[model samples]
Target: MLPLSLLNTAKGHPILVELKTGAHCHPKSPTLCEYIDQRSTVDRVTYNGHLHSCDNWMNINLHEVICTSAGGDKFWRLAEVYIRGSTIKYLRLPDQIIDIVREDREFRERRETLSGNGTGRGGRGGGSGGRGGYNNNRGGRGGGGAPRGRGGFSKQQN
Candidate 1:
């Protein structure tokens, strides 16, 4: 396993894991890569989650991997995998990323449709259902509000 710190490196080339078992290399950190080459490819690749900045081009699985923060989480995730940094082919997604992407796409489509006429979901200019009434200032839903108990009954004090 790669160290936690290495998994999130924001400077050098990304650590590459050989598609075939037992081959790994860090193009930037040659020493590490050399060591990895001696190891069996079947070994699991481990890293601290740091990788070079997305500003630079990186090839992973023969695709360009664009790294970015996930929900501002401390760990970084593949934002977009491009064939040539412009044309996106596959998305390197972590678990649960699908929902976020789907939600974003849905929101954008709803906004566009709403702006076109007077129909759509929450977004700017779509009536109360639009972004009009929703408070931008409001943050995420966060944790659930005060928990509710059975039927309208409140917990009795001892």
Candidate 2:
């Protein structure tokens, strides 16, 4: 699966967002874009912070950010920054994010088991109940009270 597709996994975790333009204004970072149009020489302005939220456009909201210049010499801290999706070059996610994702999956499975939806098919174990053992759509009724026949729906001659 696509890693960035699960943005919620990185929420409250540190992220590094580098802009394509790198206008030198800072306070900018990661976006959810497929491409970027930049003809100028790439000057990286990295925004390092904990992601608060991200939209489908790749626009990210971060807190307690420190903006670093391309030379790695300049540094400035900010309380919060909203990085536009269009300007984003790429995003750097945490290494431990996989562990967090696994934990989240396990938690959901446990909840499903508790709710009796362990089948993961909306609690529907099987299809149309013919005579019934489990999942009888009849709601515990005895198969519409139909009698056993000789051949078809009628009795045969002896």
Candidate 3:
């Protein structure tokens, strides 16, 4: 599945985003920290590490993410983050989303099987006489007209 599709499926679920470089962290002494910014949704991310403190929560933009706690103790209460699509290394998705995707796939497979339209490819007698179907002479070379010669038209000699 596409990355956007997976992101859509992961909506309203917790996600961990790992960035490509340590450029977004402390500028003077840049350190490559595994800055795991745990967010509820992947929308409008900014990677600056400036922390915003809310009631027992820290609202951070993607531009404000520092190093994650080594012991996994610190958690950021991000409001909305907008990370550049290019900077994202990988996304960690919840396990439940996997089951959802699998079920959806199985359902689609079953539907295709029941309708006899496996893979939506040209089925028996469905294509334009190229495969499986009989060539009805409906298409190609102007509907069975006389085959054109190299001279552009047949020279009629009286």
TM-score, every prediction: 0.31, 0.56, 0.46
Tens digit per residue, CA lDDT, model 2, 15-118:
99988764435324333111122324447778899999988888889999988766687577788888888898888888788777877888988886675422
lDDT of 3: 0.43
List, residue by residue over 10-106, the lDDT tens digit for candidate 3. 5555566666553243333222223433432333222323222211122223333433433454455433454545555665667887788778878
Full-model lDDT for every candidate:
0.33, 0.62, 0.43
TM-score for predicted model 1 compared with the true structure: 0.31
lDDT for 158 in candidate 2 is 100
lDDT of 1 at 154: 26
Model 2 TM-score relative to the real fold:
0.56
- Model 3, which residues run further than 4 Å from truth? 23-76, 122-134, 137-158
Q: Write the per-residue lDDT of candidate 1 for residues 61-139, one digit (tens) a residue.
A: 3223322221222222333222222222232224333454556667878886665533443222322232221233321
Error at 128, model 1, angstroms: 24
Model 3 RMSD in Å is 12.8
Q: Rank the candidates by TM-score, best first.
A: 2, 3, 1
